[model samples]
Target: MYSLLFYLALRDAWNLGAIDPTSGTATLLEVTRVLGDMYSKGFRPRRSLMFCSWGAEEYGLVGSIEYVQEYVKVLGARVVSYLNLDVAVSGNYTIRSTASPLLVDAIIEASKMVPSAYDSPEQTVYDKWKKVRWNNVTNEPIIGNGLGSGSDYLGFDQLAGSSNFDASYTFNPADHGNLGSYPLYHTSYEVFSMVKKFVDPEFQAHRALGQFTGVLALILCETPVLPFNVNRYTSALRQTIDSFKTNDSTMFDLLRSATNDFGIAAEEFVARSKSMDVKNPYVIRAYNDQLLQLERAFLNPLGQGGAYSDMK
Candidate 1:
């Protein structure tokens, strides 16, 4: 199963403007609109797709976290991926995403299929992502690998152990003195008119985000081999392990050896997937189940730092 989560709550401060469209309302509209369009076009998914509108997100992720806690086992066994859209269109400078390592390839593929919000006809979201934001070491479009404690995706990522992601069409931070978020964030000025007048007047950014996210969901639902790149996990692990500046050589060697063994296993898994008999439903289910549960294996059910919810 694939799930799409959009929050329906806003900050607590009272303001003159009753409209709090940018943070949550716009995201909900884009997600529902895409789902409606998909239905109208008569596109039926091979796998299950869920549309979830979470409440009280601004009140410490109350809605989504509780839901995951209630159904962790069921979700862990069944859910393949979770896509969260909290602020879909804050700005249109470029598309930004933070995702699990397993989903990097799918996100890139979906971005390539969607056109840029304000670029030339031939330019795609992938092109903008590469040109505007990328990794210096690899010279490729950059994506956040860690799903930090912030949106609705946290529960799905850490607790349920479902591969998950959050994305937005964002403004360039340099243009706003490198502020954490847009200037009107959580303010009275975050109304529909604000989005129309300044952020995305033509709503092209919103449309682009909708199409990108929808295409990603479709890829997950329709693909037979489960478009996951397990090899990405190897790279992520190595990079993370390298970040530690510990002087304990013994511990470091143990960690490196473990990562190497995991890399070998990942390669073998990919090779097996390629040679699998796709005609057999049992075989397909077995292969796909491994891919789905790979992330769950990293979870510690007892939780991290005495907090059960921080299992991942």
Candidate 2:
């Protein structure tokens, strides 16, 4: 999936003659091609698979938002997990995975099965020098911030209530700078050879990513236990309510009431979840159904108004 997205983004960028800073049309086209290929290959079974190549992602994930609004019910019923990989290939070996605790544990366990890959000693020396220079000038740590819809993961996460993960590696700070670590990014130079050399030398990082993703897919396909953590959901709700309270007290009250109700529901779910036997099909179905409903209860109908409004 990462490779397909990468190729599509790159190809679209090339066809456009230059990057469309506003709409990212070229990027979206590439994504569409990838989805089309997957469909042609019969990758989706009886299950409903959504292949989204969101447009105007650079303008803040508009394409994805529109999609979610149009198909909330279908997404709610089937989207057990949403995995996002954006800018998957980079010059570093650091793998970062972001998700809820249940999903995070699954990713960690899967990543461990893949061997660690690192930059060469010479590359490390250059990275150290660049980091020092940036810190000396900005007085800020050079950390790659968590994922936002600089890619397509935003709508799925914030709107659909789907369990999601975004994974990437950090290598050269140069990649993020105006200088040309990724010289071809938004330019004509983002060709296959350039990616092979500067972006993912030795391909070990790419291989590790494949292994990690494959393991994750296998787990999602096979696991009888639908890993949902109510404690985390409650904490997140509290934080969201606190953040929004300064704007409207009525909204705050509504959120608080909802939070309390959700807490009660969560407790019920936890009890039921803990008691379920992994080997029982009926127990698994019941647990998964409840988990799905618990997520749906938090949906705000007037918020995003997508098919998966339960997520909002």
Candidate 3:
């Protein structure tokens, strides 16, 4: 179902002449985890698993968008979630877990299991992630920010309206704050040297990234009650909208009222969903399907143009 015509973008075909930016570390780690999961866990998932290697991500998410277009119906019906693994070792941030409401808890839990990029084995990835997040954004470690259109994640989220997210161990001063990114991006200069020497000198970040990815993926597939936080989403939305009450009191007041009502409903929904019977496969399927369709409610039916759309 892939669109061959869209697969080979002209720039990628000509400029892509060296090794991957990850230097094979992310791929190798993924392989190791997959083999381990199969052997140790023995395919205990309530649903089938999938691993995707998208080809034309840089070309406006061509590969993933086409794949989702191909499998939209089946994916919507059966897929529990989508976790993206791109730019595995971006910088050296311990972990930056940003996702839809349903995935925030799973991401945080997985982070607690992996080693921190900081010192001490006792300090888990979640500790570092929360510290970084707090230093940058809020007082507490909140599951903040919905995924926006940028990479392959766009396909699963914007196009397919699937519960999705992307994680990476990166928070370079250059990319966000006072520093600037490596000028070699999208060029031959964007080689292993930059990633190893500047981005992730120790390469432990790559392993941490892999562990986080594997854990979150397994949780989605195996957990009887999907690790989504409807209340968190509602709460965050309320907090965010509350910031601009002065702009237009009428509309802002209306929004406040709506989100507050939604928050109450979300709390009840979370309790009900979590209380489901774990032993009943039929109940799990029904509950999982509800989680899958939840994302589609946010899709703007007219959101069809540009890299930065209104959908996400």
Candidate 4:
């Protein structure tokens, strides 16, 4: 049940159903087209792939949040990944993505395979994104923007703690004042004409975005080990415990000890994943059952419904 929760539906404020251009016609439509192409090519997926186009995303994440609440049991049990796409290429900035640590490596790998539409076909998406953000001294690619509670991903990640990824190409670091953007955010003025004239005149980024997302989806679908690196998360947890120490040393000791246990468990899982017989469906099922529960390990006890659910 690793879902494709496309929040590109539900454009803002048009009373009856009409064309609302500010939403993700640019991104989601391209993905839909690509899926059709895949189907035509006789491509098949090993595991379940669910596609959901959510509605009423403007006032709140009404559609997606409710869907998760309704199917919490089945989704929580079966969902291993949730790839979300919304407002993917509305501005001039390069690729901006946020990933759970597990999918971070997969996203970087997928970007390298997708040819950049802005540059020549030889240059990859990762090449363009890394060139500006790359640190020459450290020799590491710069990190991407973080995901917040603003989009449909919040519903899945907060409610079920689903491992998730999301992104949008929008304003530069200096353009947070909202200038030099697509300028068609949530208003009736967000017509296609404005998008055509001002923002993404060539629509090249949107095309590249489709390929990038498609490649990532293929990797998740076809990979033997699910592309998850539990060690990445273990490292993250240890770093977090290092910062902002609690007043209670006992609680600190407990947290540190839990991270150690988690590290051991992750190593065992990764070893099992690597050594498992990929030809055996039962073996794959056994491996996935373990991997699917990784998301639940992050859930905090939010108890009853008060206001917001816990996102860990």
Candidate 5:
């Protein structure tokens, strides 16, 4: 359905003389106008859609970030996840999806359902064969890197706290004969003929992308529990502190000594708390209370005055 919609959109733009063969400005404007139409008529109460045709994305993630800051509170929670598809038109049948660790298991399960394009002549049966190396089982798909300040998903993942996935495939990197391939990327030569011939010859990759995104969206809509790992948060925070110390020598020396003393005390406290075990209920409560208090130390004041300072 989405593919048909996309094709129709392209067709309508072409038929209406909206194609600007020069600077790609007309293409952007056409897309923006179509999105605006969709937003006005297609969106419903309790369900909203923001169609963003970002400008200067190649320069940096400026447009998306500005949109995020402007409408974060309004759109944040409703946006369960973000699936970015910048150059989905091209690439191999190979699937690459990257998301937070909380969503990693879900993504792995989804990947297992996607049939691979690789083949082996010796094996008569065409099945999803596991790639092994040095006695180690390797059945994992080529997952891309996590969200950074690059594509459209960056602002949502970083600031708005949305789980974001960027997926693509590089089928035949050596096939330069096809004008529809990488040559059109960020260049003046990108056209319908080249895209139709090389980028997506059969649109199989496009179909696979639609399938992947459909599954992910269904999972998000149906799943009752939102997977969140506190341990991951704790580890990330620890690494951030370590990185800050490593980057600044003067602060490193000062913080290193203080952290050493604090670490010893914290370790001792944790040990004693664990030792309490099945002792008096009051003791257990006290230990749990102390641990909770430790978490509170990281919190900053919510509003007004010097009240926004962290207790720590």
Candidate 6:
């Protein structure tokens, strides 16, 4: 249940012009406008499109968690991914994301398609994102591969066992003393004036975000072969395994071997996906199902350490 005091506080804030647009309103505007624009243009997606707005998200993601818990079986089996946009435009600096490794390629592709809000017309979101955080080894923008307990994507990621994506066009943390979020987050000072004057003065960031999100959604819905990077998961797993500081050499070696084998299998899977018959509806459905259910295969039905909420 939502806290009474919190509701009163929010109402008081709203009366004083403290609109919590970043929390969800901005995203709602973006997603809705994109869908409306698509409809106006007579574009129809091959797959279904669903828009979700959950209540009490600030109250520990209460709404989304309950919904996922109720539909976990169906979502786990049929849902391809969850794209979250909470705090859509807290800053005008650059895009930040925490997503399942499977979606890294699709996200990058979408970024490349959307022009950056702050840069020259030729510069794209991918350019700005790569400039902000580059991986020296891979020469690519460093997108996070893990999700923390923060937004609505948590339920879809852990409970529904679906690949999920959460993103924001955020401010530079270096300028804000490396705070976890923007300065006026959930504060009375988070008014429309503040966003207009300081955060996104021209509203270009909002438009860019809408385009990027829309393109990503289209990629997920229209691609004949699911644009999942299965091989990327192998590297993610290897990195996670290597990050452990345990002195257990034997255990580490075993983990490395397993990761290596997983990489080989992932390579095979990618090859098969590339060579599959996309014209046959049954073949396409089965191939897509394999991609969709790969993340679910990692879930432990009983949960992590016997804690049901921690399953992933």
lDDT of 6: 0.74
1-312: candidate 1 lDDT, tens digit per residue: 443333333333234222333444555566677777888999777787777767667778888888888887788788888887776677889988988899999998999999999999899998887788888797778988878887777788888888888888889999889988776667777666777789888888887877788788888888977888999999999988988887776778888999999999999999888889999988988888898888988988676457664433
Candidate 6 lDDT, 1-312, residue by residue in tens: 000000110111222233343434555555677677988999877666667766766667787878777877767766777777667777788888778899999999999999998889999999987788779898888889878677677777777777778777888989989988766766777888988899889988778877787788888877877788999899899878878887776778877998899899999988887787878888988877787778888877775456564333
- CA-RMSD of model 1: 3.0
Among all windows of 10 consecutive residues in model 5, the one with the lowest summed lDDT is 1-10
Ranking by TM-score: 1, 6, 4, 3, 2, 5
TM-score of each: 0.89, 0.61, 0.80, 0.82, 0.52, 0.88
Per-prediction tally of clashes: 0, 5, 3, 0, 1, 0
Worst 10 residues of 4 by lDDT: 14-23
Report the number of the highest-lDDT candidate. Answer: 1
lDDT of 2 by residue, 1-312 (tens): 110111111112333323222122332344445546766997653223333444565555566667766775566666776655555555553654556433644664565455555644343322432433234543522322224555565655556656666655435464466343334555655555665666566666555555555556556645666556666577666755676636556757876897898778778878767677878877777777666555555456555545443543
Q: In model 1, where do residues sit more than 4 Å from their true spots?
A: 1-24, 246-251, 304-312
Model 2, global lDDT = 0.52
List residue ranges in candidate 4 displaced over 4 A.
1-10, 13-23, 135-140, 143-146, 175-184, 242-253, 301-312
> How close to the true structure is residue 9 of candidate 4, measured as C-alpha lDDT?
36
Which is the better candidate, 3 or 4, if ranked by TM-score? Answer: 4
| Candidate 2 positional error at 251, Å | 14
Residue pairs in collision within model 2: 69-306, 72-307, 72-308, 73-307, 299-310
lDDT of each: 0.78, 0.52, 0.62, 0.68, 0.45, 0.74
Query: Could you give candidate 5's per-residue lDDT for residues 1-312 as a string of tens digits?
Result: 010001111111112121111112332344445545655896322222233345545556566767766765543434555656555444543554555543555565555555443333232111222341111222443343356665666666655555556655444444556344354454545665665575556555455555554455445434333332223333333444676634546766665666566566666765664566554656654553343234224323331125322211
Pick out the ten consecutive residues of candidate 2 with the lowest summed lDDT: 1-10
Per-residue lDDT of candidate 3, residues 1-312 (tens digit): 111011111123214322233533354446556755686975655555665566755667787778777776666555667766654555676566567776677777787787887458788877775655653544445554677886577766766677777665665564566444334555766766667677778877776777667766667666666777777678668767866646556877777888888878777877887688879978876776666666776776655576435433
Tens digit per residue, CA lDDT, model 4, 234-292? 87677668776578767788888989999999898887677789898778777776776
* Candidate closest to the true structure, highest TM-score: 1
Q: In candidate 3, what residue range of length 10 has the lowest lDDT sum?
A: 1-10
Error of 6 at 246 (Å): 2.7
